[model samples]
Target: MGNAVISSDKWHPVLDRCLTISGEEEEEAFQLLENLASFMLPYEISASPLLQQMWYIIDNTKYDGNDKRLKALSVLTELSMGSADKMQLLIDSNKNARQVLALLLCRGKFDVRQQVLVILRNMLINLPSSIPFLVERQTVIGVSDLLTVMHPDTVILALEAMKAILENGGSPMTPENNEPSFSLLAEEASVHSRLDFLVSSPNEHVALLAMEILHEYIDPNDDDIILPDDLIDLTLHPLS
Candidate 1:
């Protein structure tokens, strides 16, 4: 019983099949992907092509079911956990990184959504240049999906991302052209209304976090906060 050698030549075919197969073969495909990720450690496998395929699979909605997308996201999260530099390089290489992230936030299941949130959190914290791009995407894709979730811990995660973006100066959303993007995102996501919901959350930590975002959104000197009339009404009559 000798240890098996894991190499790109061996794993690439498996990953390639995972990308191409669908429907009746989904479970088999997912298993291959699972094995690839497991063997990725202690073997120094090149993940570039694998990552590209995963993103490709994610973008292709035709074969989106059967937990394939979830498997892809899981592998990505695992890869990212090992190296922040790798994560940054992934973003730099993939022009659609923001688009993929936004789509995942809107479509992924609970675990998938949480992993995407962590990616966003890390990118914002470690790569300041990524702020504007991520902010625009998240605002448009709607953080409300996570913010308005039932789980208190998940709610805290979403709120934490908002706090990071704003604290890192995402509130102003520089370069004037980007300003309207955030406004539309805020309006479409009904962020102000969601903040109202979170402020009264049963979890005191959640409530405080929401309050901080709300405060930053309304900070007197900041010109970017757009409060829709409905948001005003909700604030005025929280019980109504």
Candidate 2:
């Protein structure tokens, strides 16, 4: 295919055009964008005026219902983290982007949200021990639920996210925000509490999921990870 001349002044039209295109053409469009992600291709799509317009459009739209825009956000997220400048663009736009991310998280769009969770957690995990903005400051349920579900790839991502919070949990949390800290007991208690709710669940998957999270983390291969006393007691004494 010939070059799909990227816009210089406005991406909204091109963005809309992409959505209107047939599946093949749209995939081609996405390839063009994703290709820009490679350092070798090097057209600097992030600086494009058209790309800026697309970002602005995504910020204002009801993307929960927009598959095309969701597709684009997933792609852009991957590219924007390739460098400090790009990563900062993502961080700077956190307010505008965070809402959409939260929606994806709440809605459980794992195909996209799972990847994003991994990316975000990995990025923030070792960055001098603090979150970048208000978006990061809020208590998040996404990780907790994922832990309960034992989402295969996501369990590790959730644990990575909680790592910092757990470390910081040593001090008494203000009454309203009683998040568990890294103390092995607190962490185990938090996991156990979530699991307790699932034990009576009709969904065998749910019980099994809880088992996975607990068993894997408390495995002999694992070190210093606590298993809540109740969970251990339950494990040691299964009621037939």
Candidate 3:
């Protein structure tokens, strides 16, 4: 670890060299830097510099040459270790993080998207009051786009986030309706398309969750379903 720490400043050179090599040499450079990052995890100073280099390498890879996306993500958590500012950096650095997360829902392989999703979910979960207002301003715009692209995994994770919104409950600015609309039944909710997208997922876990909610809407024995006697009270009256 100590040796790796000394070499941390030299990471940009190593990453640059790694990009030039082919076959085993290239692979070795990748492994070396990866291992170096792992060893530096205990030290914040070392990790931050190394991560900045990784992000730079990854960003540069966009113009020409080989793959660096995976590596950027590999050390993403380490880069942002306990930093509240990490989310903002992701949003700023990666313009497509949101779009790709939506696109990658129907398509997987981008594990970075999942890590990014975790960050987004945490943001929503931590700031419940602020999120609905955020949602109103299009926080959930990605969910609709992901569905159109048939990205079920992204959709499912997003729905889990949306369910929190539903649990907390808010209404979008609609043409009419004075009351707050939890009414996924209403035209404003976009419920049917949302329903169709999730229900079609081949992943059993995804499909099962979709079915659970679908049942809530169309349950034959309506009496078999349960509703909080005070759902409105729970969601509507937000205490200061």
Model 2 per-residue lDDT at 126: 37
- Candidate 2 lDDT, 1-240, residue by residue in tens: 223433233334545576467577777766655554433122445455434544653454554455555556655556444554555555454444555554555464555566556545644453323242312222245555565654644654555554444434443223224533334433443655664465455644455445445455434354434444454321211000
Against the hidden reference, what TM-scores do the models get?
A: 0.68, 0.56, 0.46
Relative to the true structure, candidate 1 reaches a TM of 0.68
- Report the candidate with higher TM-score, 2 versus 3: 2
Model 2 misplaced stretches (Cα beyond 4 Å): 1-16, 38-46, 50-62, 126-130, 134-139, 164-240
Error of 3 at 128 (Å): 9.9
Worst 10 residues of 2 by lDDT: 231-240
- Model 3: which ten-residue window has the lowest total lDDT? 231-240
Stronger candidate by lDDT (1 vs 2): 1
- Ordered list by TM-score, greatest first: 1, 2, 3
lDDT of 1 by residue, 1-240 (tens): 112534545556667777667776867766665555544543243443766777776677764554677777666655444454555555655677776787778886677777677667656655666677656645444467788778887777677666556556544344335555454456566776787788778887787667667776535354544433333211110000
- Report the Cα lDDT for candidate 1: 0.61
Best by lDDT: 1
* Clash pairs, model 1 backbone: none
